[model samples]
Every structure is written in C-alpha cells, then in structure tokens.
Target: MRYPLLMRFLFLTFLLLCASLHADESPDTIAPIRERAMEHQKAGRFAAAVDDFIKCIEEGSKTNRTGRRAEYFARIAYNQTRMGNFKDARENMEKAPRQNGWKDEDPFLMEMRAIVFLATDQIEPALQIAQKFKAVNPKKAEYFEMVAQFFGGDEKCLATPLGRFLFDPEQLLYNGAVARNPKDLIARRRRAAYFLERANQQRFPNSYPAKIPVDRGGWAHLFDPATAAGLPYSFYASAFYDLSRALEMCSSQDEPFLRVRRAGAAYGWNAVAPKNSLFISAATIAGDLKRAQKQGALDVRTQRALGDFFSETLPPVDQPNYRPRLRSGIQSYSRALYFTRDESSLRDPDWLETPETDSLQKVRAARSTLIGFHLSGKPVALPDLPPLTELAWKDYGNTLVAREELGSALEAYKKALEFDPEFVPALNNIGTVYSRLGAFDIALEWFDKAVKADPKFAIGWTNRAGVLDELGDVEKSLASYDTALGIEPQNAQTWVSRGILAMNSKSWASGQNAFAQAARLAPQNSRYAALSAFAKFANENAELPKIDLSIEDKTWLSNFFGSDSLAESYASKGAADKVFAAREWIK
Candidate 1:
C-alpha cells in the first residue's frame, strides 16, 4: 500500500548514495545521524526527520566543504517542504549551492528546490528548474515538467500569471506526458483536476440544456462527440475517467486524494445520468470512503469530501435505509468540523494550505443541511454558518424543501431573496412551497415575479402553469404551458403535466399528442407510455398502439386497471373500447 516497490527501492538507493557521497569529507559522527534523518523522511515522520536533518546540518557546518554543507541545507529544506513549512523551505533552498558542475547530489538538490518553488506557488521558477534536467535525464525531466504543469493549472498557484492557462487548448501536454509514460500519475491527476474545475464553473440549466436531440434508432447519440461537447456533465464524466486511471497508478499515500476527486466527479455524473451503465452509484462511492477510512486517519479534505458525499449524494429521503444514511452523513460532517476547528490543525501536507475560512464555511453549510433534515421544522439551535451567497442560500432552501420541512424551507428561501431580490430560483421555490400549502393566489404572484425577473427560466413558467391550473384558469394555464414548452421542449415532466391538464379539459387530441411526446422523450417510463395509450383510446382513434409491459409494468397495470392483460388487449383495435371502459381515466 506504500509507494511502488521499484520506486521505493530507487528512493532508498538514492538516499544511500547521497549519504555515502563525501563521507570522509564530513566527520564520521554525521553519517549515522544523516542516515536516520533519511529513514524518518521515508517513513513520513516529517517532524522527526526535520529535527534530525537540523542536527546533521549543525554537524556538517563545522566542516569546510561548501558543496557537502549546501547538500545538507537542501536535505533539510526537502524535509521542511514535506512538513508544510514552505517559508522555511524556501529560505533554506536559497542557501543551497547552484553550481553548473553536475554532482551525485545535484539531481536531489534541484528536485528539492523545484518542489519548494511549487509548494510556495512559484510555478515559473519551478518549471525553469524542472527543465534543467532535460538533457541529463529525459524521463525525470518529463516527470518534473508534468508536475510543474499540474501546479501551474492550480487556482491557488497565482504567484505567476502562467496559472491562468489551466490546460493547453487541446491538452496536448497532458496527452503527450501520458503517451510517453502510460503510468504517469501526475498527468492523469492534472487532467482530472482540470475537468473538475471546469465542471465547477458551469451553471446548471444553461450548461445542462433541456433539448438534447436523440436518435431513436440507437444510443449512438450518447457517444457522439458533438453531443458531449454541448453538455457540462461531460466534463465531470471525463474527470471521473481520468481520476479512475490515476487511482490505479497512485500509491496508498496518494489514494485518498484521488478517491475524493473521483467521488465528486462521480456524484456530478450520477446527478445527470443516474440510469446510465457508467453511472457511479452513491453506494459505490460510500464503499470507497469506507475502504479509505480503514487505511488510516484521513486529512481534512478527505473528511470534507466524505461528509459531502454522505450528506448530499445519498438516495432520497423517501428511499429505504435513508435514515441510516442521514445519520452517517451527520456524523461525517461533525467529524469534518472537529478536524477543522483550527487552521493549523488541518494538515494537508500533500498540497499548500487551503484557506481555513473557506473550509469552515463549506463544512458548516454541509452540517446545516444535515441538521435541517434532522430538525424538520422543529426548532433547534443551528450552527453559525458564514454568510452565504444568494445561490448558496437558495440551494440550502431547496434541500430543506426536499426534507419536507416546509416552514424552515420558506424562511431559508426568503433569506435568499434578502441577498438578491430578483433571484429566480428562490422566487420559484417560494411559489412552490405556497402551492403545496394550497395558497394558489400567492404562489401565482411569486411565480409571476420569478418569470418577470428571468423570462428564460422555463421552470418558473412551468410552475406558473401549474398554479394557474390549480386556480381553474384553464386558458391561461394552457397558454403558460405553451410558453414553457417553447423554451424547454424536451422537459418530459412538463409535457406530462400539460397532458394531464389537457385531459381534464377534455381536449383528447391535444392530450394524446402531449402524452406521446412525453413518451418519446422518456421511453423508459411505463407511466408515460400508459398515459399516451389512454389518451389515444379516449380520442376514439381507429388504430391503437400496444404498451410495452415489463414485469414491473404488468404489476403497475394490474394495480391501476384491475387486470394485467388489458395492456396486451389494447394491441387489437376491436378490444380498444373495452380496454378504455375498464378504468375511469377521470382521476
């Protein structure tokens, strides 16, 4: 579970060589101390290694050999970098000699300096040093360059303007690195991080457009490059793929970080395509976290990722075992908060220091989500969360609504409105809560405000239609449905709602067409198929199409119509009238 055997062997060999170099130049008293320091560094006891390394440096300074003393400085700096003491590492790295002549310790010295630069967000300097090894060691140079590029793409690596180039337009650098070495962990991780960041920046509904054209002949459209190019979720899918590859090559020390990234990408993909074969289930991600937990203690980032996965990515509240999942999520968030009690306590030695304030805000928000679910409209003391943006507050309100805490949800939505009066989602959700409370007139006003704020918001228009229907304004409701469908024609639920409205108004042909469109858009749903057939039967059509009934579909048909065979009977036009008379569609 440690680093690969060959890599460990090479690292130990390098350590031994460095220790043996100029052994007689330094006092024999320093040899055993330096060896112990190397052992401590390799064992991940960075604090102990730093202490031992300092002692060795103190002993080496008594000798007159400048090169050997400079090497000791570099050695201490490497340990300091591993301990997240980048400021001290940088100071020590500056004291190390940078002569043009190659020596046994030169490669280690250069690598330590580059690592210090990268740790301190100095990407350009890191790249410069990384390139120096190109002539002497091409593979090592490639590895360092890939590492430099990875840091260059980091959002926090702002010491140089080159950080803005997240990836090459075609990602040729990452691709070339992987091509040269298929097991290049840095290249794979960099690619994954790039896509994950891109996915984070994309807005919902716009990035996830409604009208994705489908070729009914087959699922070839799903695999089409053009189709993927238009969807933001494709970035998440790509990130998941790259992270999976990286995890295969990563050591156990690196596994938690990669697993957490992959889990995030998996959650995003599952949100968009839960029924796809490639969809990573919440259970699978939960298992991954469990395995990681069993490995040893987790860092703050890993714990936070685990908390988010449990709290937000689990199955819905109505599903079985949801209570257990919710409890687990709450515990995970609590643990995250426990670890993040202080900035210094959160040790993320693998990367630079993450903003402690930002970490706290996210952990607090996640805890609030679980707490809101637990309280469910009951008064309870909540965590003092940092101020959230309108979008964040609105999302929290949505989560409360999902938990069925209507009163608290309304309060949260109103809070979002205080931040941005014209926030459309908050307005629409407020309307939805009122509608659920049977306040149709108030819901209509809120819906109107939402659409007025953002006329392009199809969901707002759809809600307006539903409220109008509740108020018995049939003509206006139909008009609203038309407007909504025009904006987002591929929304199958909107079509279904519109079809129901048409059926109530006795517009048989319109209902039939709406239900048929819904069926075509979501062919996997047997309910849409049933609704379409019923609408056709109600229209007195001469030709009646049969409904495809799976075993579950047959059970549903039996429960709804008192006979499972009625769907099969509908295939023959002669029995269509009898099938229609079997159940009243006026519910």
Candidate 2:
C-alpha cells in the first residue's frame, strides 16, 4: 500500500537507522521521539510527525555524521513534499549540504530542488537545475530534458520547439515530469488531473479552468490535449505514449484500468483528437491488459479495474465497432470472478454484485442493450480473434446469462470447462443455469462436479446447499450448509441461510443461534437484522417490535427516490439508501 518513489523509500529506510544520529544532547529523549515521528510519516500521517521532528531538530544535539545536517533537512523536505508544503520543502533542500566541488553532483539535492521549483511558480529555476543535473549525470538525461522541455524555457533540451506557441507553465511542469520519467506509472497518471481543465478550455481558450485543489496534484481546467492549442500535437501524442507504456509496465497492485477513466482519457485529448489514433492506442492497451490477465500477470483488482474501465471507455455509444467493444468490456469485468479473494467483506458500491451478475453482471446488461439495438438491423460484424483463456470464457458465459441466452451461456461454460476441467466457478454456474431450466437432477450433477473440482470453495458448497434446499432435499441441504460454514465461518449470508432453513424445519434454538451469528457478523444487513429479530421472538415467546419510521427520514427518502412505494418498503427495512439501488428499482 505504501509504494514510494525510490528516494522516498531510501528516506524512510534511513529514518529509524538515523533516529538517534543526533550528537548526545538528550539522545535518549530525541531517539524515541524521532522514531515515532518517522513511523507516522511512513504511515502517511504527516501532520502528526511534523511537530516531533521539529522538536528533535531544535532540542537534540547535532551529530557528526557525514552530511548529517543536510540529510536531516532533506528528511524534513521529504515530509513537506508529501504534505504540499513546497515552500518549506524548498527551504530545507536549500539548507541541505552542498559539495565543496559542485552542487550539481548531489543527485538527491538536485532532484528535490527541481521538484520544488516545478511545483511553485519558479519554472525557469527548476528547468535550469534539471539541465545542470542532466549535464552532471548524463544517465538521467531523459528526466532533465523532459523538465526543461516541460517549462518551454530552453530550446536545447528539445530537438525542435515542442510547445512553440504557448500554454501555462504549470501544465508543462507536470507533462514534462511525466515525459522525463516515462516508465514511472505515478508520474504518467498525473495527466488525469487535467480532465475538467481540458474540457472547458475547448470553448474558452486563454481563460481559466475549474478551481480544483492543486495540493492533490489534480487540475480542474478547460484545455484538451487533442486540440491544436498553445501546446503542439506532439505533446498530446507523447502523453498517449506515456499512458500506454505505463499500462504495459503495470502489475497486479494497480487499478490501472480504472485510472484511465479517472485520468479522463475518454474526454481528454484522446476523445477530442481529430485522429482516432489515441483511442486506438488505448484499445490496444486494453487488449494488452487482457493478455496480461491470461498470462496471470495481473492481480484480481487490476482485472476488475480494467473490466470497469473497458466498459466505461468503450468508444462512445455510436462507433461502428460498438458491439465488439461491448463484448470485450463484459469479458474484462468477468475477470473479477476469476479471483478467489473473499470479497464479501468489500463494502464499496463499485464492487457490488448479485447471484447471477457477480461483480460484472451489470456490464452484461449494458452489452444486452447494445445487442438489442444491433438486432434492429443487420448488426456490425466483429473480427474473430483467437480464443481467450478458460477464465475469459467463463466471463463471456456470465454475459450470456445476463442476456438470457441460456443455451449459449451453457456452451460458453462448457468451453471454459474444456480449457480448465477443474475451474469451480464455471462448473457451479453451469449447475445454476440448469437449475433455472428446471433440470434439477442435471444441475446437481454439475454441483457435485464443482465441489469435487474445488472442495475448498466456500461459495460452491453454499450454492450446492441452496440448490438442494430448493429441490426438496432438506436433510442434504442442511449438511451442505454445515460443510460451507465449516470452510468459511465468517460468511454472514451462509449463516443467514442456515438460520432460515432451521426456522423452516421448526428447529427454534438452532435457528436463533444461526441468526444471532449472522447479525453479529453483518449488523448493517437489514435481512440479517430482521431474521435475527424474528428468530429471537420465536425462541423467547415475545412479541415482535412495531415499526417506528421517523416522518423526516421517510419524507427525505420519498423525495430522493421520487417513488413512495419503494421508499415505504425501504422505510420498513430501515434501509433508505437501498430503496433506489439499481437491482431494487429494476425489480
């Protein structure tokens, strides 16, 4: 979670080592204080550490370590940099130890100074420092040249005039920094901050963009990189290259796909550019992300992120290739199901799923809408590519389920099983589809296979139990639920299911205990709360509490959703927010 720049990593690594580096003046007092401050900084609690470090610097005796004073100042500047205290970061960098021979030789000092100057209004100074450093250390010349070109101050850095006409210096600073460090994904994503800025700038050039917080390094402006404005076309092209390169370089740790949307690639120059090359480039990267998933190069979150990004960024609504784009997007979202992480604990709205939809079923619905539109005429044909991995086929099958193409969904699921015979999700889902078609006996066969394939999968066990319960095999269902519970004791939904099953069988004590566990595990779930309350009443021979809806809360919910019937239902459950949720509203 704490992925730092290489130098920042060094700064943190040294914090504890140099904790007691102060020369003897209350070294005992200073060491612990310094250690805690450094710990706070590592945890991203900058304000908490600032006061302690300041106290250490003021009260502790100066140590005789080489460049100790300079290092101390640099540490302060590093913290200041994170907090957007550019003024103090710059001051500290200036006070840092300089070499007797030449200051440019100090890479850390030069890098920090350039960073500070770039952030502030001193573009020229930053560019000059970068140029000197590039000369001092030619190996990092790319970074130096990028900074100089970013400010549009020195022609020597650029083979030709880059921004020959004009643009704000601040824009150049971020852009140049990214160009200088093309492989650094964080630097590359800084461009996303300019989304709104580029948008409004289209109609109002040479004017102000939105007022966004620069402290977070985002720009709320009205300038698009695609438009031939003060900056040349090459500038936008370079940015496109940077993003593509970053995507290629990205690993499982990043939500790089979603970052495309956050970066506003769709609305940035890529969306607005006269040439379709940028969009094409992005689409290519989208493919690369998929290939990465196939090769197991990406993490589950990245796949999910890409799936979300792919759906959201699909070549607008009117492109000729929209159908292929839709399928691709759906397939991407399906990747979320491939991971085995117990995501029931994830409470993010973006990750919400259903029995059929899982995380990406919503994207499948969008695909269906497009599919129906295509059926109005002869649909655009998609070029056939090589088959995807077993995981991708499973994803495609999920889309088929959403489209109500049940037979075709089965075929896709079968294909998934072909690639990886033991893939449990595909096996379980096949059983689910058969259950839908009233083939309970056949569905049970698939469920048996699923549990056999991956006995450890808690969901598979839970699904098998639910199916058995539906098919009038109560004894088998109860046993299956127990098996699932044994595997995943924290599964709140499983507890709730077991509670309901026990209640149906008149096992009052068992029902109450199960419901109580469910409520304890998921207190916010209205279903769990209602079931637990009911179970308690049944067990204790007590009356259920009457509903007490507040008039204010009811009215607010009614007005927000514009539907009294839905509001009343939610008001009963005390789940006002869920009243207008997509699944609920659709139902």
Candidate 3:
C-alpha cells in the first residue's frame, strides 16, 4: 500500500510544476485574486483594480461556456469604465454576447451596459436600458427605478421605500462615478449634476401638505446642497445650492466619499512649471494639446497651446525674469504668428485662423521679454490702442505692466473696469497695483471684490494672502495662503511665500522643508534656491539658547516636530547637536 520513493518524488515534482504554471495563469485561476480585485473596485481603487479585472476576463474568455465569457466581459467593462478607458470598456461590451440566453438578462451585465452609456453622456439610452430591469429583475427594481426617476423627473418615486435606499449617498456615489468625466477635470461637477437631477423630481412636489421626511434623513443628498435643513422651496435655490457645492468641493479637504472620489481629488494640485503654480488639470492640458497638434502649426489650436505655455502662469505674478522654457515657447508661438503679415489680427482671413481678436499678439509681447517676433525682419507691429472694449483695455494694461508704468497700468485697469464692471481680471490687477504701491488696505479691498466676483479665481486668494501678509495679520495671512494653496497647490511663488512665513515664525526646520519644496517646484528661481541654501546652513549651525522650555513647548517639540527623543536627549545626554536641533523651532 505504501508508495515507492521514485513514485513519491515524481508526484512531488509534478505538483511543483503545476504550481509554477499556475503563477502564470489568468487571475481567475486563483479565487482570492479575483476576490481582491472586487474588493479594490468596491474601495474605488479603479486604476489598480483594472489589471486584475482584465486577467479575470481573460480566464473567463478562455472558457468554452459562452455565458461565463459574457459575464466576465460585462463585469470587466464596468471596471474599465471607472478607469476612464472608454475604448476598452466599449470593446469589452461589444465582445460580450448579447444573444446568450439568461446571460443577456443578467442584472450586472445590464447595469454595466447602462453605466457605459451613462458615463459617455448618453442618458436617454442608459435610462431605457435601466428601465428594462424594473420588471425583469425584482431585487434590482429599486436601483433601476432610481435611475428612471433621475432622468424622468418625479419626486413621488423618491418618497417610496426603495427610493430612500437608492437615493442614499452610497447609491448616488455609484451614479457619480458614471457621470461624463474622463480626465477628472471636475468630480464635484458630476456630483452637482447628480443632485440637480435628483432635485428635479421635487421641482414642484404635488403633496399639498409638503410631506418632507421627518428623519429618514438627507445624508445621501449632502452633496446636493439644495436639501439643506432650512432652505426655501424654490428649485432655483436648490440648483444654485448644488452649483455652490460643486465649486466649494473643488478644494474641500474632508470629503466623506474619498473612496468614490476621482484621482484628481488626491493629487490634483502640484507645480507644473518652474516659478509658477496654477490650478491646471495636466491630463486635460496634455489631452487638449495632443488633439490640437493634429490640425498643423498654422491651426489656431496649435498656436494657442504654445501661447498658453509661453504666457500663462498662476496668479500672473509680474515676474520680469522668465525662465528659458518661456522664451523658447514664445519663440515658437511668434514664429507661427509671423507666418502671417503685421496685419489686423491672429484671425486675418488670408491667415486661415479663427475669429480671435487682434489683441492676442500684443498681449503675448506684453507677457514676456522675448522679441515680438522670431524673425526680426517679420516683426509684429504694435497698433496704437484707443481701448473701447474690456479686452483691448486689458491688453493695454498688460503693456503698461510690462513697461513698469504702474500709473498707466492703473488707468488702463480703470478703463477696463468701466467697459466691463464685472471683469474679475481687472479687479485682481487693481489689487496687484495697489499691493505694489504698498497700499495694503486698498489692495485687500480689491482682492476681496475680485474673489467675490469669481470665488474660483485662485489668483484672488493668492493676491489676497500677500496683502494680508503685508498688513501684518499673520494668522489671517497664513489661513488665506493655505486657502490659496488648497485651490492651486502647484504655485511655486506661493510655496516660497509660505516658506517665508514659516521662517518668520522661527520654525527653522519647517521653513527649511517648505523652501526645499519651493526649490524643487521651481529650480530655475534663484530666490527659492538661495532661501533653501540659507535654511540648510541655518539648520546645520543650530545653537540652543539659554532660555528654559515650558513643558507644553517641550511636549509640542517632541510630538509634532519629529524630535520624539528630545526630552530624554536634553535631560540625560549632553549631545550639543541634539540640544541645538531641539531648540530649532522653540520660542
């Protein structure tokens, strides 16, 4: 009955070979791998979950069973949709068998199909597919009903038991994931649309007594600011509320639904270029330029992409010294523009460009120190400006700013404001001029108005923070600066300013770290590099003062300052380095 030694060895070797082969097998070969992928999907780790789902789909497709293959394809399509891979999602959906019996009616398959359509902004088609589930799938009837109601506009459906569950934050978040966004330019924009759709049902509720749910709760609709506890009953109010929530959510730190949040929500803001920081979706910028380049160099799209690279900076700091990249990019843009004559505009009929204004060339010149044209022989002639319009005046102001003629710039800004009273850029520029002139209070006023004119104008916050710092409201200044960073964390100038504030506060190490960040963000900025070097030198030469530390200060330094062994070091050890390092941030 006992096995021979040779047979036992052969059996063990076969098992080892099988194990080795399994490592290279599709994800579904291991049940736990598939389960982990599902877990990743549920946790909104879409990018990571995508590969695992594809492996599972490959395993399923390898099977002879048509139903199993269809199910895998359908499931993977949902994951692909979440990953912003519209092409892959569509291909998977197409490959899945529509005629396979029962698999055709599978709720998950049907839901994914609707999801794909919805994600691409095909609402009517998605709603129709979702509607089929109402009678065909009883367990999912509530979910399908919720979808129909979102598109159908009926509050009565929401008052139903199923509606309560389906309209909850959990459900709306799933729908938000399916909203029309690929590069994540705006997650809150999608969430806003979700709430706006939900609120449409209640545009004019027919329940005469106005039977609002006493406490079944409005948590699901938190993203829908319209459903706030004490709002007046106007659809406009609700819609506007959602709109406000959308903008506010652009930088809110503590969004509860981080799991369902877009990738941008995590790392959306960071320095894209040297000595400049602005709120830019790098994905959108790259995507747009790629699309534009297909049209050729003469195309307005191509020129504009180059122009943005040349002239655009967050908050438009009057940085007289531009980096080499700016000059190179502007040189490229000017070369394209020079192809046409010193004629009327960027849109001369013979130039074969679109209807952009004549001011674009002038504005470009004003924005940079580069020669107005790449070819000196083909120099762009500056036309005399009697500014009748806001844009013309704005360009004139730009010219004045370039020349350091603050008085003339101020007048030009005034003219711009007179032409268009709500011009936010002029408002910001007025603040900039006043700040430059050391008129801090007036500058702050204009900055406030600029933000009021357009809260999403990140430059307003940055400019306002500078004014606040000048006025010596240190706490308020810090808060304002933080707000600006929240809005557009990529601004290297702002990081430099933040570092200066840290240095002023005598948090030497924190200031050093902040300066390092600024230097990393803008290595071309000589000022930031100098400040970083100084901070490092200061830290290296740290010397403890004779002043005794309070227990609270000691606790703070130990806990928050990453010097956890400070108390022990200062008391037991006479290490001069430890003493000095511990005192680096102390009062």
Candidate 4:
C-alpha cells in the first residue's frame, strides 16, 4: 500500500493489461438489446419486442455489429408473425438486413413469411412467396413441395373450363367408358388430346407443363399420366402421339382429314431436328442422300426432296463446322513452349505464338476483357475468297459474298447469273442474299423468276414469304406461307414462321393456336413450348397484372406471381423463370 509512486503506477499498468487480455468479448455491441428483444418476444409483448429490435437494428447499422443487426431483424420478423401482422412480417422479413457471408438469414426469413401466409390460409400468396424463394435458391426443394400441396389440393379445384376436363376424379370409370363407347371415346379423347397437346405446345420448350414447378399443383401430370397413357406413344412422350393414335383409331370414312391431321403431326415432330436447332436430322438426311444417289433414275419429286434435305442439312448458323482450326505447327509450338518455360515470362512466348490461345485465356480471366478486346464495336472484315477460274468476275463476286460482304455477295450472285443465265440455285441464292440486305425489290424480282422457272419449288414459296413479310405485306406473306405449307405441311419451322406472322397481325388467338399446333408437331422445341404458354395465357381468363416492362421477362411462374400467395401456389418447384414467363400469358 505504501509503495513508491513509479512502482505503484507500473504494477497498476501490468494489472490493467492482464484484465484487458482476459475480458469476455461482446461479439456485437448491441448484444444486450438483442437479448432484451428476445425476452420481450418470449413474454408475448410482440409490439414492444418489435420496437426494441428495430432500435437494436438501428444501433447496429450505426456501428459494425453485424450479428446484432441480423438478430434484431430476425426477432422483429418473428414477433410480427406472432402478433398476426402477416403483411408487416412479410415486409420485415424481405427487408431483413443481409450480413456479409452470413448463411441462412435471407432464406430463413422467406420461409417464415411463407409460414405466416399459410397460417392465415392465404394459400395463393403463400405459394407465390415460397416459389420466389425457391427460384432464387433452387437447392430448397421443400419450399416447392409446400406450395404445390396447397395449389394441387387433394381434390382439384373446379375453377375453370379446362379443369372440368382435366381434374376428373373418376379416372378408372372414364377408362371403362372409353372401351365401351369407342366412338365417343375417340371423339372426346381426340378433342381432349388436341386441346391438351395445344396447351403442351408453346414457343418456349422450357414452358412445357413438366417444366412447371412441381409446387404449382402438378397440373402437367394431368395428361401425361391419364389421357396420354391410352394413346400409342404416350402423349407424355410426344404431344402428337395421342393425335396420331386417334387418327388410326377413327373410322375409315374419316380418311382425308385424318391424313391431313397425321401429316400435320408428322411435320411438327418430324421436321424438328434432334439435340439442337439443326434444320434436319443428320441421320435422316444422310439416309435420304444415300437413297437418292443409289437410285440414279429417281423421280423429280425425289430429286427435289434430296435438294430440300441438302438445304436443311447445312451446319448450324452459330456453330458452323466449316472452318476447322488448322492444328498444324502453330499449335504444336504453342504447347511445346508451355512445357519448356519455367518462369512466367518464358511462357509469354507460348501465349504470343497462339493468339487465339491468349485471347481465349483473356476471356477466361474476365468476360469484360473478352468483349472489350475481341468482340467490341469492331466491324467484321471478310477474308478474300480463293479465285474461281471458270469466270473471273463471277469468282471475284463469290469471294466477296463468302466474306459476308453483302454488296459483294449481291454483285457476285449477279455475275454468276450473268455467266450461267439459267442457274436456278444461283438466282434463288442471289434473291435470298439480297433480301437479307433489305433489298426487297431486287429480291422479289429474282424470287419471281425462280418460282416461274421452278413452279413447284417449296423454297421459292417460303423465301417469297420471307421477302413479303419484310415488305410489310403480311396477308400476302401468310398466303405464301400457306403455299409452302401445302407443299410441306409437316415443317415445324414454317409453322413457327406463320405463327409469328399471325402474332404480328394481332391475331393472338390464331397465333397461339398455330404455335400450339407447331409445338405438338415438335414436342422438344423450347421456343415452341414458350410461345404456346404465352398463347394459352392469352386465351385464359386468369388475370395478369401489368408489371414493369423494364424487368427482364423470365417466362416462368415464379417471376409473375412473385410474393403473391396465389401466384406462389402455381409456381414450379423446379424452374421459376419459365413459370414467371408463363404467368404473363394468363391475362
């Protein structure tokens, strides 16, 4: 107690330092406020708890008390729910302060809000919010199921006309009726299948019923399980499968229309290329070519068919396989340098040798770099085409065309036509090339001559329609499309083209119908599926609110319904974007 002043000060400093090191740290400065809020919440003083939590959150916001901020927000949300303030709770939950790298806070809040809606029997709203949450975070499959169970009630809701046909509880009894009343069965089933297939076929493939979130009441399962199962190839497998079977099952007196129906189905499904947007199935085209070559005396129709096959079988527009990378010494040296270089600088030459490699690497480094360096606002310069000796000017013209020099392409085509005045393909190609360059008049002149020379050419009719459409002559364009369809009704692309024209003409009903028909013909087409959904929504009585046009159209249910209970109820458990996209068509 009587120690010297300096010794006492030194001893006190050491003691204070020791105490500071051993102090029980508060993770959040507002920890006491968070604890008080929880206590108030537990005592059923929800409003008081909310007030305290809000204060805590405000305090945390001022300071860097992240944990306390989240705790307060989470508590406030819970108390709001307990007080039966569903709307307030939803707002609070949605506005819950996000913590850097803090897991589960946002989703937990979303899940709680969904529960509040469910407690109040706001089934639709519950489903919509749950679906939004699920879409944002797909790993939570439970959220999807939660909404689906409510929308897809144990007994289907008898709300709409389609529901009467679709939500039949007495499935087994209906099956028995189909067997006994064969004619009626054929009629009903055919009509039912037609409508169902129409619904199934949309412009966007992702819009298929199956693609709808499982949480939205499993409506897609309607036809796939019951009605479609009775058909030849289940409608589940192919939308046209049941229609095809119906054609076979129907009476022989119905032969002519049946052929038309069958042909329509064939065109829809058959014309669609497998895998991607390839115009024709390579296997099928190859087989056709082999047959045509083997039978040298094939008829004109067969020859033309082969030509059509050739036209469609060309490589995809984006991923053209024409230019294979040289893969010569340039690539070998590049790889060799990578192995030899020990220092990063030495590897510089390896990168330099292969410009594409370095460019690709830069793209990988950052997408912005790729766009800035390679694909920015630069014009595409075409490489000169190798000279063709037959006619010097013609060769020059073709070289320009090959380089995507539109003017040059037109000039080349003209030169080629000058050399061989009766070259039908060249004339047709010239018209198409010119049409692409927006030279409608010139394109029309050439197309007219091509059609006159080859009256039965389907391409001429299709191409003529394209030019007509560009020229804003929709009615005539539609006529041309019809002419093309008459020659080849099974072409899905042509159906799509016609459907687009119809849509552009404000024939939403007919446009959707046409799109549906096209989708039925090609079940796997995503664009067709999406368009079909849009069409159905257009026809349906369900209201679609006018959302902001600036928002990116998701083409899915989750996006449309958003946090609304009814919207959530119909959203897909799996893909939300497609579901939101579909919702727009509802009104």
**lDDT per residue (tens digit) for residues 17-128 in model 4:** 7755544353555778778876776554557788888888677666644454544555576666554344566566556546432345367655655554443334566667
Q: Residue by residue across 45-150, what tens digits does model 2's lDDT show?
A: 5556666677666644444323234545666766665443556776766766552222445786666566555544356676677677766677554554454454
Candidate 4 runs further than 4 Å off: 1-399, 541-587
lDDT, candidate 1, equals 0.64
Q: Itemize residue pairs with steric clashes in candidate 1.
A: none
Runs of candidate 2 with Cα error greater than 4 angstroms are: 1-184, 192-238, 244-271, 275-290, 296-298, 313-324, 337-587
- Colliding pairs, model 2: 192-263, 196-221, 197-221, 197-222, 197-223, 198-222, 198-223, 198-224, 201-222
Q: Give the TM-score of candidate 2.
A: 0.30
Ranking by lDDT: 1, 2, 3, 4
Please give each candidate's TM-score.
0.32, 0.30, 0.32, 0.29
Candidate 1: regions farther than 4 A off: 1-182, 203-223, 274-278, 281-283, 340-357, 379-587
Candidate 4, residue 499: the lDDT equals: 77
Judging by lDDT against the true structure, name the best candidate.
1
At residue 300, what lDDT does model 1 achieve?
A: 56
Cα lDDT of model 1 by residue, 160-255, tens digit: 343223223334444445545556787667656655555654525444333323111011111222343345455676677667667766888778
In lDDT terms, how accurate is model 3? 0.52
